[model samples]
Target chain A: AQKVTQAQTEISVVEKEDVTLDCVYETRDTTYYLFWYKQPPSGELVFLIRRNSFDEQNEISGRYSWNFQKSTSSFNFTITASQVVDSAVYFCALSEGTYSSASKIIFGSGTRLSIRP
Target chain B: NAGVTQTPKFRILKIGQSMTLQCTQDMNHNYMYWYRQDPGMGLKLIYYSVGAGITDKGEVPNGYNVSRSTTEDFPLRLELAAPSQTSVYFCASRYTGTDNEQFFGPGTRLTVL
Candidate 1:
């Protein structure tokens, strides 16, 4: 079974400040995919990023970035100079792939981020 | 492209009543999923289909049922409504592959009184 854990239930930061969301996962599969999704107040989930176990390279997308570490089984997301629009619930998910449809994805509890101006 | 569409954005059902949540994807994806989000919690998978005519139970699939008769549609049905089943439901789909990203629908908010 694959399980994802997002320790922080809620986080608050002032606008333009930097914030990091922590995500740790547990999976026995040798190969799997990790994903980050954002759900704003509108209640629609927006796909943020996806990283696989083989690639631990850190990624930076404009104001958003992700650090994938295999040794520690952690995939953390960071926001640089976050704005009010960044306020949303962020989720970490894991999926095992073996070219079979039986492999299902699991999600964490989620971290609710509040950006205040 | 109307990526993933879910019908009945908001619904309220009485106890013992039943309803179906409709989901359709135009992306020609082979994988579709149904998930429910409770208060202060992440989404829990209810059911998923890898392709048409193939459906499987997910983590929390006890109260719900799903059928995939076509590649484009996956509908979730609640047999007997209960207060515990009241939550926001989201439908998503992804192409068959390891790196394919899952596209999500706006979501359906269901309330059972």
Candidate 2:
């Protein structure tokens, strides 16, 4: 079974400050997909990013970025110069493969981020 | 186009009552899923269907049932409502591909007393 763990339950940071949310996963499969999703106060799930096992390359999307490290089985997300709009609950998820019997994605407990002024 | 739509955004049910949560997707997705979100917790999959007439149980499928009679509609049924069953439910769909992303609906908030 694949399991995702987001150690930080909640985080607070001042506006325009940088913050990083940690995510660690456990999966026996050699290949799998990792994803990050954001749910704001409006209660809508928004897809942030998706990373596969083979591709450990870091990604930067405007003010958001992700670092995937296979050695530690970690996929961390960082927000640079975060604004008040960035306050939301972030979730880390894992899906094994397309052919896996249970292709259903499993998610972590989530990290609630609060951006203060 | 409405990627995914769930009806009855908010509902209240009494104990022993039953109701169905309607979900529909216009994106022609082959995989559809139902998930529930509890307080301070991540979403847990309740059920999923690969295609029409093919439904399977997910992590937490107790006290709930689902049916996929068409490619566009998947409805979730709660046989007997319980207080513990109160939570927000979300419907999502994904196309047939390895790198596919699941598009989610706004979600239905159900309260049982």
Candidate 3:
């Protein structure tokens, strides 16, 4: 079985503030994939980032960055200079990357981030 | 490309009523999935199909059913509408491979009373 935990249920910050959302995961498979999804008020989930277990290198896409630490089994996402548009429920997800579980994906409860102007 | 699309963007159902939620993708993805999102909760997988005719249940599959008769279409069915079944349903599809990015649909909001 696989599980994802987003400890922070909700967080609020003013615009331009940097916020980091933490994600922890548990999986029996030695290899797996981690993902972050954003669900805005519109109710549609938008895929933010996807990282495989093998690639521990951090990623930076404009204002968004992700830290994947295999040793700690944590994948954290950070939004620098967050804007009001970034306010949304962010979800951390996991999937078995090995052939053991195929492509079953599991999601965490989610963290509602609010960026006020 | 239309990516992924769902029908009846919103629907209201009476107790015990039945309906099917439609999902289609133009990307020719081999893996399709059905997930339901509740208020303040992450999306829960209900069912998935690797290809046409191959379907499997996911974490929360009690009140729903799904069928994948064609590569481009996967439909989810709710046999007996209940308030507990009310949620926002999302359809997603991904290419045939491990750890691939899944494209999501706009979602369908269903209310049961």
**The candidate that achieves the highest TM-score relative to the unseen native structure:** 2
| TM-score of every candidate's chain A | 0.96, 0.96, 0.95
For each candidate, what is the lDDT? 0.92, 0.94, 0.92
- Candidate 2 residue spans exceeding 4 A from truth: A99-102
Give lDDT tens digits, candidate 1, residues A1-117: 789999999999999999999999999989888999999998899899989889989999999999999999999999999999999999999988754544577899999999999
Error of 3 at B3 (Å): 0.7
Tell me the spans in candidate 1 whose CA falls farther than 4 Å from its real position: A99-102
Best by lDDT: 2
For model 2 chain B, the run of ten residues with the poorest summed lDDT: B94-103
Off by over 4 Å in 3: A99-101
Question: Model 1: which residue pairs collide?
Answer: none
DockQ of each model vs. true complex: 0.62, 0.59, 0.59
- TM-scores of all models? 0.97, 0.97, 0.96
Candidate 3 DockQ category? medium
- Residues B37-91, candidate 2: write the lDDT tens digits: 9989999999999999999999999999999999999999999899999999999
Q: Could you tell me the TM-score of candidate 1?
A: 0.97
